[model samples]
Target chain A: MSIERLFIANRGEIAVRIIRAAKELGITTIQAYSEGDADMLAVKLADESVCIGPAKATESYLNINGVVAAAIEKSADAVHPGYGFLSESPEFARAIEQAGIKFVGPSADTIERMGDKVAARQAAEAAGVPVVPGSKGRIESVDEAVEVAAKVGYPVMVKAAAGGGGKGIRIAENEDELRTLAPQAQQEAAAAFGDGGLYVERSVKSPRHIEVQIVGDGKKAVHFYERECSLQRRRQKVWEEAGADCLDDQTRENLCMAAVALAESVNYRGAGTLEYLYEESTNEFFFIEMNTRIQVEHPVTEMITGFDLVQEMIRVCGGESLSVSQDQVKKSGHAIEVRLNAEDPFMQFLPWPGKVERLKIPEGEGIRFDHFMYEGYQIPPFYDSLIGKLIVHGKDRTDAISKMATALESLEINGLKTTVPLHKALAKDPGVASGDFHTQWLEPWLEAGNLTPENT
Target chain B: MAQVLSPLPGTFYMKPSPEAALYKNPGDPVAVGDTIGLIEVMKTFIEVKAEFAGTFSAYLAVDGVPVTAGQALAELVV
Candidate 1:
């Protein structure tokens, strides 16, 4: 049941990435695009192309029916949803399954089960993965919240069960604080989402965003180690590194094994990541959630482990077994990846969708830039601002940082304002170089004017 | 007659949301700094404001259509 033709139902740099991987596996690539994306790089590189719908995403990329119809029309053997969009959509996967086309990901049932926060937490607990100690379910009154807070230990986070995007969240240092904040959070939640249910959980102080990359074949699963993505702004990761230096060997082993345990418990398929909140001081990590698809920072894991995750996922989803054993999946060196977005860093990171007049990419043994841009290519403004990702590998973390700094200097994309300057400043910053930061570190660093032109 | 040009190249929306009313209609009064429409660029919405007080004549660009930078979006009679 090997896939002979793979249809990519996404756009941007990831679309180009999938096409390259599919071609390397001797699979014919069919790229689906909207009217505005007809001139995109993936469309030009794929073996065949089809227009799904109009420029609007509702009628195009995000349109499940349109994407599935296009794949069926092209007679694609499998559909590769490159992260975001429909990558984690159970409905899309069901539709593709009903069409009798292979979906290069987990089954629809797995997606649905893991997509729910409460269900995912329960699964993690059943698999012996450590989750944040908290209330079992929604708490009704302030007295119940105080009882849960007493056991979980304060400073605990009082969160609205139905709220998202950091809304209706409050931190309470003690029972008194929880009593006062719980009622407000409940009221806000009821007003915003029509749900007053509350969930209380212990908050990890100065947490680092660490995640383990795992891939499975619906029977067995293995881990590819961990990645640290603590440097973020507005909840979006700006920089990422593989083989978190902050973790000791024993902790890293335990973390990776726990991720595999969960993956195998669900008979997970394709590439997935288990995100965790790692506290350096306590040397403890708690399972946050599992991303049901390949992630944006997957290249860093690939660089260190030397595994083409995309190709492996395609093969396994096509009915092949795990390619490598746990002992055989060895890691070497350190890798760093910085998101290169089409943004004006000096202008408060405003979106800049200018044409790429000229392009000069750094080329070396350890430097790689995954992008979908070319000279004279006008970046479409209707999508995300991520134009590319610059990845560099070296002997160790220090060496990787130095190589990244040099690569940032040589890389150029003319006629467009990018986040290059921001990365340049970060590469040389003392805090980043020492790897002494947390999830809440980047915003304050930016506020202190560390990214000024003169600083870089 | 003066033309209101789009500030960015992206989709143009006459209403804030699909179910919301239009921000401005033909023959409506427009004051300086009044929002006439919105231009969505790379998922970020930027308000297109009237630079001069005038009477709204007509929209030159269709709603929910792609527009280029500095393209005429609407007409205003000063």
Candidate 2:
């Protein structure tokens, strides 16, 4: 590998994750942290550490110039931006490349293209990937709306071109309903935003969040299969599983191939994910967007495929070709990952950051807890609440869920409130075990007081 | 004289938003349950409400500065 020295441009558990991967690759890891994160675990684990800026992320982790300068000053050969912060910033990638340091992800151009919604949708369509059936643009008349609706199928959602907060929106189950609702929506929109322009889209009912993980060497690409992240609250994934059990073998093959096709079409480099909204009833998947960097749920994919994604991405971005091919990438058992956040799950998921007074992690095969916490560590309240992620692998989905439940029972972090009880309740939920949940399931479940003390 | 303590550990904001005016200025009257400031913890903005009615004296903690739980945020003349 050409990357002899790696600078980690992120913090928290992902920072620790990158350091470990870089160390295993025989590379010196330089951790970049804020003033408040001087005592973070990643700093201690890295071969060297530097403070980029203050506690505020806007002036620190998200500061491209500061991060780039720190990396260059440290004589780093490459920079690895873990998930969040500047991970998907094209400017950051370009700055690193211009500074004669490799960025452990896609090219700046690729990041910019994939970051755009319209551009990415066009790319997906050009690559023969199915996108959510919708109007080409704003429909001027009810006739145009109906024409678009017939092709996209029913039920359809009529939305205002300039609308927010659920205003000027209506759902129609059939043509008759569309005929009635479209004009009403148009009038409402015109009255509200003074723009009667409307658009129609095939409303995906009870959609499940599925994404395929793909890696490329900017020449060829391959997929590591799919992950189901349907369990979400406030649109943030709470629990994720690899090799979505909801998909059949044929559907899984098609979904994975479609992702690889999209990745190859863009000449994508390093790790990327193609998020799709899948409808269970029709077994149809619609491409939504692409994440240009590694994700929080990446470890679940790693657990099932036994592929070190971080190391692989580093190798490829360091001017090396993909070390593994499509056929060589094989997935074994099912794996589930639950995010452990520093929040009081019972109290409206309020953020609770405090010193770690005691720590006890579950230990056994098929169990992995990726975290940056240690005894006496004080978790700073300046960043996101994600403290750790608990992952488990098993022979199948049921077995994985069982292992997760047992692991949650043994895992303990004292002197701080966390979402442990939330995961414990989910692990035992019959709806979760039967895979009968959707992307909108968790919030309503919480609203129904399902995460009570007795449930945990 | 009394002090209004922070209910949580985080960055304290005297205003609702960057462009907004201060919730209470020095010498402003403060009533029970009136919002005095906001404490942003882990990206969640929680309102810091006054528990004791008094005349607002001065802010003990600087705006947009980090503060620990029970830290005096503002002084009040009872």
Candidate 3:
């Protein structure tokens, strides 16, 4: 099971990170890119590269056959799908395995189970994990939704059962909003995930978003503590930090155990994040969902634990057992990560893609920048605007914030607007610094400043 | 500019499922709304229309091939 050549079915900083990790393990890396990304960092860093298709994500990144053909053409022994795109698709994983190439993630059945929100909920409930009160299956029409909402009580969260990135979720205050928003949510979910399944849950107000990172080998598993990702805009995480400050020791232990139990129940392998909504008042945390791939904020956990998660994932794919026991896991210091996007934060966060004429990255002891940019690199008009991530780790949250502030001040990229100003403002906010924030913290704060429209 | 248009993301069907005539062929003068090809995604069939008045140039992806989003199903000489 010694992998010699590996094909990366992704692009950007995470792809670059995976390439480096593969190179470290004496595995030749083949980087796959879309048309605009042919000259990107991952292409330059890998031992080989291939342009799968044009710049549009659906053709290049999400195309199952195209990615499989690239791996087969390169004669790669394994394929590592970094976060986003087809990372969590069970069909893609099955295709790679059918092509006689090892997929550097979990089993197809495991992915299939965890991918369906209802099935995953059943698994969680079966494992005795605390889950939010919600419907057990997809609601087809408005009547079913109303009936479920009535039983679940008022102020329920209507979610696209097959959705992610907060795209198709609606918070309904009454029966009318639920009925009105259901069709729109279904259409969006159909367009995005190709599934229009809907579900209901009692909306947990003012809960801090906490998730536990776990690495398993289909046999043994261990938890890597928790990350408090309450600082989010539009359900997309803007900032993340390791060792959630609000969690007491008992709560942290319980949360970690819940994550482990959930993983063990499904025999999940590689890196996955078990998300939960933690209510500080009751010290109760309920299982939300599990991301079946490497997370965007994985670097924060890696910073605290001193483990190369990408490399470990590769090793697990090659049939390696769990490298560390539960007792060996330790959370040290603090790390904060911000996604640097080529976006106009003032213009409702619209995509601002162009060329980077001048780029200056930060340099300091605790500042780490994961980016795919250089001077004169064209910020392509296609794909996600996340050009990089600025991750700063320190001995404490205050020190991490100060380092991130300094790093943001020093970092510069011209020829396109970015979310740098927004991150800078967030870092300086007292509420964010004190960790006295909830899931709905960012919108109201930004609206009060007139930074965005009220609905935004 | 000769705008080369193609099908959006969908499954490609060439010969109307072995019972009907082929949609179009090379050198066919197609109007804007002419049915040049059929693409399906998630069990829904959508006709690939020529965005502008053009002559169908070539078929880039073969019939029955699963075309992804932004894939070139056919080249159009506008």
Top model number, TM-score: 2
Could you tell me which residue pairs clash in candidate 3? B11-B40
Model 3 lDDT per residue over A283-337, tens place: 7788989998999899999888888888988998888898888999887899999
Worst 10 residues of 2 chain A by lDDT: A159-168
TM-scores for every candidate against the unseen true structure: 0.96, 0.99, 0.76
| Fnat for the candidates in order | 0.88, 0.69, 0.00
Give the CA lDDT, 0 to 100, for residue A370 in model 1.
98
What is each candidate's DockQ, to 2 decimals?
0.92, 0.84, 0.05
lDDT of 2 by residue, A368-408 (tens): 99999999999999999999999999999999999999999
Which candidate comes out best when scored by lDDT? 1
Order the candidate numbers by lDDT, best to worst. 1, 2, 3
Q: Which parts of model 2 are misplaced by more than 4 Å? A: none
Q: Which residue ranges in model 3 land beyond 4 Å of their true spot?
A: A134-201, A450-456, B1-78
Clashing pairs in 1: none
Greater TM-score among 1 and 2 belongs to 2
Judge candidate 3 at residue A374 and give its lDDT.
84
Ranking by TM-score: 2, 1, 3
